[model samples]
Target: MQSQNELRNLLQRIDHKSYPAYKDTRGSYDFGNYVLSIDHVQGDPFAAPSKVSVHVRGGAAKFPADLYRMKCRRLAVCDYLLRQFGQELERVSFKAKGSGKSGLLAVSRPGQEVLERTACQMDEAKGDLVLRFEVGFPANGRTVNARELEKIFFTFLPECVSHSLFYKALDEKAVYRAADLAEDQQYIRDHLKEQGLVAFVADASILPRESGVSGRPMKDAVKFTAPESMKVSFALPHAGKIQGMGIKKGITLIVGGGYHGKSTLLKALELGVYNHIAGDGREYVITDDTAMKIRAEDGRSIKKVDISMFINDLPNGKDTSAFRTEDASGSTSQAANVVEAMEAGAETFLIDEDTSATNFMIRDELMQRVVNREDEPITPFIDRIRELYEQYGISTILVAGSSGSYFHVADCIVQMNRYKPQEITAFAKEEADRFPLPEVKPPKQAAPTFERAVRPDRAFKEDARMKLKTMGRDGISINRDTIDVRYVEQLADTEQLAALAYFLKYAEIHVFNGKRTLRESVSLLMQYVEEHGLAAVTESSYVPCGLAMPRAQEIFACINRYRRISL
Candidate 1:
């Protein structure tokens, strides 16, 4: 370990030298308040910023163990502190300048969703908290601007760390409140299954987004209110005696006219797996952690997913039992999505009519009568929605605008009228009785087999040990072959997509064998994640600030969409 003065002296010694001189600063320094570690130095200021970390331990930061005792609460605190640190960095960032990206300071900025990310992590048992970020080392073209760099390491960073990481210098009440909210959020999650509910939307919760492009809540949007019939209450550990609309564990239908809150409410439920920031208005809006937002994904590749239960008896004699498709139609793609999600252990499915294939969703009586059962190979979701709930114990919360066919199968129906939800199960049931649902033949299989002999293409393995990157928030590039996940709607951030990319790479290197099933492999992959955190997925064991923990469901989605996946 080097002292802060020693670092200052070394920087002064290397002043006005070539850019390579900055590499000497890549080491640990004890700076009284925190130990700063320069993990990796960029070759040039124009390149990506250097990887850096700051460590605070031994009661130096003053965050309590009790507050971070639970993993959820720990993540909440980390998210809060990371944002705080980012704000502090904004104050001093680029204050000292040189050439290219010189003197720039940044961290992985968090969004509305509170995901467990690599930006910051704390081990309460060891009293160790580490914040990882990036810095653009000061340089004038190819020459080292060590004095400017010195200001960053010795001055700006210390002030930022002191203000954000330490409990004494921070907003104590806000910190505790964040921790408390996480506890309450976690409590609701744990109790949802016990309460026979798949999801809950808190009263006065804002479901509408600011715009199509933004995830932030719409300003002064109509608050959600549950009808008396659907209203249920939960006494959370921290926030006592809260009331909300409890979506029971069965088939739920969100029905309304255009521009109503049907899809908006479903959107809230789609992201309900994560805990929101206090003022995000969807704080208490939570769904089953295993919930998946499934939709039709045309042109997606499928490898040996048994979509037989949903779509069988193909005209071309292709096997639906172990289905394989390079370019699937909308109906077949949606079927694959459902099976893949179920394989990922999804207990609840959130489907929007806008995104789903109409034929896959339902067949009207007129169409059914004209087409006949023998000619039709696909069994629309309407037929299996009830059996799926009763036999398999899987639940569905579908947003339907065009069809009331789902009303016959739905256990609970909530009609969104002008952005307010009113329980209309009785009304829907009466209306549905007058209009009888079409008759359908059930599938032969009880449940689709998720097990498959999976491996990477032989050519891919020889060419590259690992080559992958997240394509923004939409897809992933694996050995130049892309896995399109644009239709995997619940993907919250690009950081989570990056985590999925690494997870797939990790799975290929560590977990995947010729024999392990998709479910088994992903289970093993997620188990490793649970034990070691997202940092373990980095092949080199280097912690990266860019990763945010993705649910096992998204991991399945990534793999299912991979073009190179072979059986």
Candidate 2:
């Protein structure tokens, strides 16, 4: 077994590329030279500290750099094992946080599922555990001291591994041994079948061909480079930890309990698209030239923006004026930012639920009408993105928790849970029939509970408690219960305030708007209604009697007018 210093010395010998140069605030160049940061540390109380998370800088290229590191890791590990346990029947146990400590781990074995001849144990090892993948060794029951074992393990898979070693893990079946074309096709088909994914090699596959820039143009699509089934960590320091699974083209449902790396994965996908390198670890192999990133704009201080002014900048303005909102240009600006990325040559459209919601729901009905009319607000944006891929050959990748809306629109689905990602059939009833959704009972609204059995006498204080549950996909619901005066908060933004106001209208007309009453807010609205010379029309839009005074109408009449829309 070698010492940590010896391992570092060996790692320092590996070749690396010029570090990526970064421009500082003062415009100074910083090279992308590989820097070996401490990934994790393990030390025996009686021995030297074991440091992991080392990487050999391969080069300036994105995914290859990490791959190079992995290669160096393999070399280090193999070398260490060869030197320390050469021909020795010693049991080697590798452990991860959650993935059991010891098992019939996969080594450089020929079979996909090979079990080494040894009883595997997953107990908590004393030293730090930061080895690449898993480890398997012949068992000898000989107990090596912690210091020697740490030294040997650290010798191989040095954090400072090199790029030349990064082997892009490829499908073995993709390798063609025969010269026959039919054999090659059969090989590829068998590979796909074994991988459990649909494989088609058309003169023009819908995916590769559809993503072209001019052939069949897809609307509102996204492009990710070198999409992999499992999550790949794509940044330095963190190195090659699994981040998020990358899907080629389709709706990826990144769903899980709260804070389970769903949004992190989505953001990583966006960053990879924008930079062509891994944002943190996950990288994309973009085949096309364009990628777009779309997100929501929460700032609402801007009272007004000319919608027509921005709409005029579209490739062909067909009058989307009816869907204009307080932040029309801002909304359009968000969409346009993505569109500009596409126009400039982005094939992929990276958008989240929030941005899509704000952009699409600005004028839901009118936008839907535009989409139906072939003048898409969001969906057409998607269609055009697909057109860029399909017509001109562009690719798309969209992420959403509620992918039910995007199933028909996407070509595939990358199902992700926590950090683990797996590819599944985009359409239902495909080979993915094994991934059955767990049946969950629909969330029921609990009976109303009063804040206090008796009313409080304080006029300023409120004892009103409301428990609301918003329905979620597959019987999941978000329940919110609070006694605070949330409804009284000032309008944070037009969209949020508007949504809250609409919700309040169902409860009581005399809702709070900041510290003032709705009447005070109505006065401001009255001013806008008058300023726009829409007093008659806007008045009728809210109240049918043309009454200037605020009064509650019958619930039935209000329900009838609105047709009982629910969240």
Candidate 3:
């Protein structure tokens, strides 16, 4: 350990030396109020920024214990502090600057929701708060600028720490309010099934986006109001007596014309797995965490999945049970996705016809008449949807515009017209009774069992070095293979991707074995994360600063997509 003055002197001694000289500055320094640690140094100015952390004792910061007494509340405080630190960094203009990435400071950037992250952590047992961030470490071309580096360490950082860490410098009410909102959202989600609902959208919530590509709420979007038939209310701990449209746990349909908010409402429901910020328009919208969005992914890989429930009797003698395909058709892929979701413990399915396979969704009377039941290999989802709910307790919320065949099986129906939902289950039932289709025979086989053997050839060596990198939000490159997750709609943030990449590598090293199934391995990986926090995934010497928690479902999907899997 060294004093701040001594660290400054070391930086001065390394000035104008080769870039490798910056390595000597990697050590802990006592800065009175906080202890600063430069855990890792960048090899070059153009390389990734240096890893740094600041630790402030609990007594110095004076934060209330209640703020972190609960896991959800603690995460909220960590998110708030990260935002405050980012704001402080934006306010400061460094006096010394040089080449690429010089004089820049950054923490993990947050999305619309607050998540458990490694960027900031509070250890109540140790009575300390640790904030991890990245610094460029000022440089002149390839040479170090010791004077500018001293200013960053001794001057700029202390101000950021003071304003962001101390309870007095922050708006206490705002922080508490954010935590309360997060808690209330969790409470609502926890009670959704108890209330006999699959999803809930609060009254006055905005469901429209700024654009098709943008996730931000529209400026003049219509406020949501529940129809009298579907409107339900819940009394939460922090937020008392909130009213919303509670989608019941059964086969439900949303039907309307084009551009009439059918997809928008479903989008909100899909995203409801996460608790939004207070002013995020859909803050009170909550759904089951196990709810997975089902869609057609034609090019995705399927490994040893039991999609035989929906697909069987191929043209050739291709077995649907223990199915393995490198490139699946649209209908086959959708069926596999649903089965995989079920294997991973998905309780509810959210589907939109726009993104679904036309033939897989429904085969009407005309098509059934043209092709005999014995001749057709596919069983439309409409026939099995009711059976899925009644037998398995699995619920489905589907958006359908072209087909009324689903009306026969639907327990609830809501029409979205001009951005407003209307309960039309009665109307839909009457229409179905007036013009019913031919009675269809149920499939012969029972639900297929999901089982797969771990491939012994895919074993990961303990001493082997492997690298992981995130390719946008939907893909991760691990060693030589690229895991495609483009159809995984639940992965909302890049931080989650980064964390997932680390978890995959971590799983390969620690959890994978020939004895454990992929699902079992993923469960063990999640259990490890639960016990050790997100930092456990990273092997870097410095604390991992940008990791966010991802659901076990997504992690399982990632592992299944790896082409190296053997049945």
Candidate 4:
């Protein structure tokens, strides 16, 4: 490796050269304390930034092994470092005259939630910590700006590395606290069934957010309190012997008037699948990792899904067993969503009445009297919810403010009042008995199959020019088509969407064949990630820094939404 001064001299000599001349700097430079490697160079200043990495020996960085001993803790530290790097980049005020994204310094930007990412990795075996980031190298039009480049590499970078990597320079207490929170969150999720619970909310947990789009907690939000009937305690590794409301593993209903915190509590539970950062107000909240949030999507495409369990016997005798639709109604779309989630291995379903189709969720006795059972084609969720738990061992947590028909099937009922939850299963049962629920016939279709065969398509092949870009947090642009994931509520961050796009491409090239089911394909991709890390998905010479782990469900959801699927 060349010395840092040698790199500086090379940059000075290359000043005023064409931007392509920057490619000559692609090599390792020894900076005494750490080694900087320019792995890939951009074609021009207008293109995506060049890939850069820094490696510090364990003795130099002085980060304790315990800080990253556990996988959860390691991911937390990586996320923390990424955030620090972003802040440091913001402070650099240098402007090298150039066009489009020129002279910019950036790292993998994190969202509200902290997740395991590939931006930073700890190599315990090698005793080295590696940080991968991007740099828009300085350029004046098409020529190199060596002075500005020197400032970025020699001055700004070393400071960022010193501040973010060293133990003494960091807030040690905050780092340990974030790691501990993540550990406790994982512990709660891992032992949910052992504690006879599907979800948990600690006594002082904050349920209300500041607004619709904000993940930050609302100021003066009421602290959650568990009713005596539903209260349960856990002995966590870090925060020992904490008490919380343990939602039982079966049909659960959250019921109350509007603005009474019913949906607020449900929203908290939905987000509990992810481990939040320290002081995020929902750090202690935990739920099953396989939980999926389901809602009605009016225009989603469905391909060969067996939604026959929920809807059958159409007016024109359409085949519900192998349903295919370009534009589905509210009820059919909701039914398809549930079946698709099941195929993707969801163990718990979270639903809110506000976003759900009214007819699909319930059928009152009045409606039963007005319309004969044979005339109605849709089998409401109320009829199959118990069967979901009893037959398939699946659990559901539903928010119902307008319907009490669900009370008859719910195994546990929690009523929210002023953001406090109280167990009201018996009271709900009494009320349900007073107002009789409609007796509905079960659909005569066979049990839905989770497996669907995907034909090998050339569109995702290595030779294909697949353009994968994230369209915010809800959608992705793949080649010429866009995959809409607005209703896939569990996709918590944009990084996951970005990673999913690449994973789909990886699957098309490496995992997918004509014989394997979509689920099998996703499993293979996940197995690859587990063995090779997230960086393995990238086919380019430069390692991407903005990838977060995505669930198999979300991966297949993106694949299914692709317009070229041949089911």
Candidate lDDT values, in order: 0.87, 0.29, 0.85, 0.84
In candidate 3, list every pair of residues with a backbone clash: none
Between candidates 2 and 4, which one is better according to lDDT?
A: 4
Give per-residue CA lDDT, model 2, range 1-567, as digits (tens). Answer: 234444334334321211111000111111123222332222212222222222223232122222213322222222222222211212333321111121122222111111111111011211111112223211112211223333333433322222122223222222111112222222332333233222121211111112322223134323222235343332222222213223444333444444444454454433221111111122222112124445444322111122331233344554433222333344554543443333233444556664554444232334455554334333224323334455544455555564343444456665544434445544443533454322222222221111111111122123222222212111111123211212111111122222222333323323222343322333444454334422232222221211111112111111111211220
Worst 10 residues of 2 by lDDT: 19-28
Tell me the TM-score of model 3: 0.97
Ranking by lDDT: 1, 3, 4, 2
Error of 4 at 97 (Å): 6.1
Per-residue lDDT of model 3, residues 1-567, tens digit only: 799989988988998888889899889999998899998899988899888999888888778888877777778888888888888877764454877777878888777777878888887554478999888888888888877888888889889899889888999999899888888898999899888998999999999988876777899889999999998998988889999899999999999999999999999998899888877799988989899999999988898888888989999889898888999999999999888888888899999999999888888888889988889888888878888898888999999998888888899999999999999999899989987978887786778685665553344564446667888787888777788888888888878888888887777677776678777887888888888778987877777787888888888787778776554
**Poorest 10 consecutive residues by lDDT, candidate 1:** 456-465
Off by over 4 Å in 1: 457-465
- Whole-model lDDT, model 3: 0.85
Highest lDDT scorer: 1
Most TM-score-accurate candidate: 1
Model 3 residue 125 distance off true place after TM-score fit, in angstroms: 4.3
Candidate 4, poorest ten consecutive residues by summed lDDT: 93-102
Cα misplacement distance, residue 70 of candidate 3 (Å): 0.7
Error of 4 at 306 (Å): 0.7
Candidates 1 and 4: which is better by lDDT? 1
| Candidate 3 wrong stretches, greater than 4 Å | 93-95, 124-127, 456-459
Could you tell me the lDDT of residue 83 within candidate 3? 86
Write the residue-wise lDDT of candidate 4 on 470-508 in tens digits.
Answer: 988879887767889887887888889889988877877
